[model samples]
Target: MADEEEPKTAFVDESAVPSAQASGEENGSLGNSWSEVSDMRQGLHQRHVQMISIAGTIGTGLFLGSGTSLARAGPVGALLGYTIIGAIVCNVVLAVGEMGALLPLSGGIVRYTETFVDPALSFAIGWNQVYSGCKSTFCDKSGKAATLIQWWITINNAVWIVVFGSVMTVSTLLFVRVYGEMEFFFATLKICLIIIVNVTALVVVCGGGPNGVATGFTYWRNPGPFVQYLGIEGALGRFLGFWTTFSNAAYAYAGSDSIVVAAAETRNPRQTIPHAAKRVFARVAIFYIITIFFVGLLVPSDNEQLLSASGTAASPFVIGANIARIPVLPSVINAIVITSAWSSGNAGMLNNSRYLFGMAKHGHAPKIFLRLNRFGVPYCAVLLITLFMSLAFMSLSKGAATVFTWLQSLVSIGALITWTTISVTYLRFYYGCKAQGIDRNELPWKSPFQPYAIWASLFFLVLIMLTSGYKVFLHDHWATESFISSYINIPIFLVLYLSYKFINRTNIIPLSEIPIRPLLEHAQRFPEPPEEPKQGWKKLNIFWN
Candidate 1:
């Protein structure tokens, strides 16, 4: 699956000036395609793009759910799981960024898939994302399983739901610059929290706390590194525990694709996106990997608090802090995480509307979704997507709550399906260039390592998807809900793809007809201005630069 045998491919160089530029054709193929001339406002700045990638994925999942991984896999096992997934996620984002640099289309990978692969594929993934994005935002972080939920007053879920729903709706419907800035501020706070947690954990590990007990590698050696998951013994149990964390780590890294999610709304996307892609991995390494390492060092996996469903009280940082006799950290982490939840929801809403807009543009969704407001936002799409926020109020009725659970079940596998489809689409694009004798360098940004990164990423992603519900098959673990949620999307995606393909009579686009040249020429004809070089103190802002 990695490579194909060399066929009689054309060797003619496509380096000459494209016909559109040579003829000064203003209304040629460049302006007609969906990838070109988006009506979406280009208001997201370079800093916004950079921070979107950084903060979009760092949510309560990292702050709270990370404890679950440590409990299951112990310290060393959990660290390995996050590290492995982090590397794969880096590749996934790079694949999206490479294409986005050239096309900079709205709907991120959805638009890219339609152009490089089959429109049917895009239709399938695009709707999948819309459904998942809308539902996940409400389902996420709303669980009662938290100790630090400092709600000012217990109010009706309906009222709070309406309030949050209104916020998401209004923010996305406004000028995109406003949305970008909101994300920028949220990302900055998340960054600071991670830094604080990591530093605090490191200090505690080094005996900086009142306990004055420097217990370096103490937890690792006492209970050992690997855990005997599900009461199974020895290496297999340890390996299973370690592997389960992949799913948890994946949840933590779920939204790394934000760099290209609103590509059309980004200013100077060609430069901004590639730079964001290159830096995102480093940011993840520093933030997630290093933080996880400290988590392992500071907290023992055997701690019962690690398994508790409580909020920041169960956060590994808080648990570690308490072990070192620090008390105020929980409130601090809790306060920021509430905002993070809202921020994550905001991102989901923005992404949901954009995906619908992209689908409508590609003729896969209702035409109304294409309607834009004075602010250049897909207002119609925003309204339609927010309808799902009503699901939040369903918890009021027991029967309705049951239905909501099943609804949530349907979207569990969406992220895995999304990543797999992205890899497949990118592979097609990578080879299409080869089959057409086009140089990759001709494009605005070419990701380092041809096919290998994506190929490896695809392999691991498929493995994770296959094993996602493995626990459901274990002794006494035959859960109907879990099984359905894990595997149902497989047939659903196939149905969406094959149904669209048969009805529309679509075929896998041949490499030669994939339209790389037209889009490349279009990009060249309207090249983005080169980014100005950094000067003086601005150079210190490495993360957002």
Candidate 2:
């Protein structure tokens, strides 16, 4: 979030951008005025950012959380839910990617929200990210660490929580490149695992399993596609099922924004950010939609194991393997699932620290959080975030893990809110650019469909976010905790937004006053690198490369 403020001397003088700088000089200097907010090094290579995106996104929400979605929505509902949400996520990626590639700042989303929309909005979203990132890591680490550790013997999950927490904390404190490399390695592993699961699902569907049964769409036929919800019966119930699964889809796509956040630390972000953002749609299609499709084919939505309390049997891959009577595959898949959880926790730490650092850099948070170590790590923010990892210890208490699960539901809500904010920010940015007489074609990246895509996505996302737990409000379908976790963030977000606005009396930047000209000139000064030449097997590596 915050980094060592690069000296203003590093910036170009008035002689550099003579026209725009001189114009702004009368009001406020642009290039000389703005770049001082944050100064993180660009140590993340193209590979690092690509894999970081993969690692952040393809995590537990896909590996294990899909089970509940399958059970609640049935196969068709689950698939449609994820597909629709994935599309919305792609739109968000494009919006953020366009802005991020041009600006490429640390905490790009939060910073953009502040600059284009409202500072109060940015402040609320920034701290929401911090709190969401910190609180959610605990239950995630505790549960997954327990699963992996207990493979050997029955032991307290608290022990494993401490172990994994220390490892992640230490790893995060390492140099930025080291952290990038570590994530790249883990991300590749997760990618490989997803491929293996997809392949295995294909085999299982084709009767390659020990059962010698060609599963095909038998489960979908039997379950009859849409799942009825809350005994409401018929189409409305099915629709509710689909709507409920949106939150699960949200959880799966949580980390897509991490790419935008990491722009400051990314190499050739003007080129890399857009390139990576363009690839998001393909990755979601192949990695998530395809996997979910096969998952629907291989595992029945009604399978009791789909809701396993320990989260082991609930993994559709595990269910498929067991159904096929495949030897050792279940255990291996479970192991991979464990690692994915840890990877998510690690990714969260990295993203949230940057978010906090961004807040501090922008003066929305304490300056102490701006402290950076020799390696350019936000030491204070990292230390504080790590301290919150101890919240996982609460899982040791009876029923507390369940409570934690309910609380963790808020993570998906936070993600939806974050995405909505991004879309709104992008709309403001698009209009602001038009208002300033800037040509969209001159930008580093131009997202397709303009404000329409963002508006449609934002509207539906708000609809989903508001009704994510709609069933809890139904008659005799009530759970107080569920209702709270699902909708409480809405009012809380408003409170944060309004409180900040009321306190600061912050007004949205006028289109005429928005520093679009200097920002465009700044981008013009640094043209993106030429496209790299590719050949032979290297060209084929485009799937991951």
Candidate 3:
């Protein structure tokens, strides 16, 4: 008050001030100077980046959870459920690609939110993702009680979380050079495994292998093509059941946004992000849909293996393997499912670290997180995220399977919120671009249908949220406590938003002063060619270059 605190300004002059230098001026006396921090090394090639994105989205959910979804909705219901969800997911990818191709920063959704939406929105999404990722390990659901087999399964999952987390953490700490190579190898291995399973299934379907047979489409008719549980109560029961099944299916597709998190690490994000986004949608839809399609045709949804009273590995995939009389395939698929969970957790850790970093940069987190290690890794932030994740693993002590289901519910809410925000942000981005007189054609990647796509996506997201919580209001047989817990994410987000507003004493900015133009321009930094080669033979001959 002595000097009458210099009037706070919303807009800074980029031309007059350097970003690195301005860090100190903007936030006085911050410990580390941004200028001294070396730029991150570009290590991930386009191919590796794309595949990692692909692997991140396609996880154990499809391999394992699809069976549960198929059982709940039958073949036609499952197909329709995923189709609708897939459309929404694709729209999200498009919207995300539009923003990411421009920004291509490591901060991902958090960064985008900060730029286009309110700072509070950014904080909410970042914190929610961080919380979600840290708690993911406790969600595995393959264990029993007392029996040696059950004890082994529980111990196995626990060991997996620690070992996988440590390995991924150490690998991430290495120079980007090593990290990129390892991720590429891991992603390729996983992809190869998927192809093997798919091809094996195809061969079996076409009467190629030992247990071969053209098993026509008899299974569908055998099961009567649908499994109706809603009774003939009316449209209400049917509607509630549809929502319940859709929510379950959406959980299977929850990690689709993991690709967006890798934007910062990729070499040429503008060129690579769109390709990766497209591949994510295509792979998820085709892989999951076709696999389930075959499963429906091969094994009835009501088959004992597909609808085991116990929800362990007794899913349709496992059942299909057993039905085909394939030796060792069931075990192989189980192992791959575990690895898929590990990969998903690994990606989650990476994502949370960046989200933490973004929050710190935006003044919502401690300044310590903004400091980078010599390798340009945000070591403090990574360590913090890991610690949180480790603590989250404590939920496993309660019960891994139960914990996983709860976590999945939270994941559904988080994903829905994030997707909806992406759409809203895109709408703002579009109008800002137009108002700024920016040429959409000149942008490296433009989302098709503009405002319409954004609006449509937003509409679907709202529908999902409402439908997701519908069971709580209508189903007397369902546990009220469980229903409330499942829908808690909605209230949690509201509380977070309101608390942030109270703390900051802030009001929504007027539409005219929203600062969307600058944000849109900032996001457009993608598509620019890198100043140097990232890897391969070109990297090895740097001296000659």
Candidate 4:
């Protein structure tokens, strides 16, 4: 591959780009922008990258939350909800993959925001995601705090909180391979859990369980495939309930950008990152959609346990197992779910810290965060962001539950905004490539469906955000909590973007001014190593490949 030479492509000056400086600070702790993309060590191997994506994407949200979705939206509505959200998330993964293959930069959407859109917007998204990302980690870790109690373990939550928190923290601080292997083990457990859940559901659906009731489609017929929200009998209530699924589904698929978040630290990223992205979407999408379909068949929407707040408590599969009179299944599902929560927390921490590190390198964050550890991680950024893990402790507080709920709302909205930003940023990159006479074929990876797919993702993401709190306005259904939680992030994002724009005095970059050619040419010069042939079991190992 290196022997083949191509015609020269013209490069552009980055200074012409908005708020983009190519130089590192005088101290040199912060490396040159494009030269080292935060200088993270490439400690993650091919399998590590794949497992991280798999482990992070499959979490408690899918394990237990699907039951609640079924209760609110019914079987048909829940299936529709997960399907639409999964498609949108798949689009996001594609967009991010295409960009990451070419740019191979850390910070994920934040880096792409600065390069393709505007640096100021990058500042907004970077800070917003940092806040919300930590909140998500809080959600996952707090879920773990509830795990012991949910399984009747009788352990002190605060004590286990420190222990879980310490394990997650130490894993991130060490060599990245340590994090990768740890997630690999967790991911293996998660996959096995999913297979078990699905198999058990299928068996019960076919009347193979202890009771052998053979209720095939019986519940769907009785519940009639839709819910009447707030006792508003008729199609209007069912429609409202169906609409609520988008919010719920969005919460489950929040971190779609994670696969490419560590491009700088991944081995052979041009190949590794995008390959992981493409496969992750397909695998994760099917896992959510098919699993939801099975869930609908196995459990009824009106079951009271579906109303439980914790995923383990409200898990449809667990409920299904209970219906089939399988006593050990609940504990098994609960154990797997505990691991899923911890796995997601590991991913959340790793991605958020990398975002901070990239922001520091790009002058959007404090330079102090540029400092890296001996293992090549941004130790300072990890240390600073780790403080937010304390927020998870609020879940243990009796009165802080409401505050935590509001924070979760804000975090969910933040995820919607993030996917929306990704769509917009990729659109800009697409047009900029066209304007500069760069061919998509020449890029390291090209996404199919182009601008149309991205536009659709953007459309649905906006619609979901706008309608997130629709229930609050449904005459006589107003709730202060719903109003605050639903629409609060809109103003917050606008204020962050606008305030940073005015304070920094930056302009929205013109398509012509975007330095796409330079980055593309850089990618051309430093090509990734050709992928080696897989032998024997590796070729047969469909899951990891």
| Per-model TM-score versus the true fold | 0.90, 0.93, 0.83, 0.93
Greater-TM-score candidate between 1 and 2 = 2
Please list all clashing residue pairs in model 3, or write none if there are none.
Answer: 102-523, 103-523, 139-404
**Residue pairs in clash, model 1:** 146-311, 147-311
lDDT of 4: 0.77
Task: Give candidate 3's TM-score.
Answer: 0.83
Q: Compose the digit string of candidate 1's lDDT tens values, residues 161-221.
A: 6666688679888888788888888889988998898888778778887799888899899
Please report, in order, the local distance difference test score of every candidate based on alpha carbons.
0.76, 0.78, 0.62, 0.77
**Tens-digit lDDT track of model 4 for 35-55:** 443346677777888777665
Q: Positional deviation of 38 in candidate 3, in angstroms? A: 4.6
Regions of model 4 farther than 4 Å from truth: 1-31, 35-38, 309-311, 399-405
Which stretches of model 1 miss by more than 4 angstroms? 1-38, 142-148, 151-159, 393-412
- Cα lDDT, model 2, residue 275: 75
Deviation from native of the Cα of residue 167 in model 3, angstroms = 2.0
Question: Which candidate, 3 or 4, would have the higher lDDT against the true structure?
Answer: 4
Compared with the true structure, what per-residue lDDT tens digits does model 2 show for residues 280-373?
8878998899999999998888888887766566678888888888999888888877877888888888888888877776667887887878
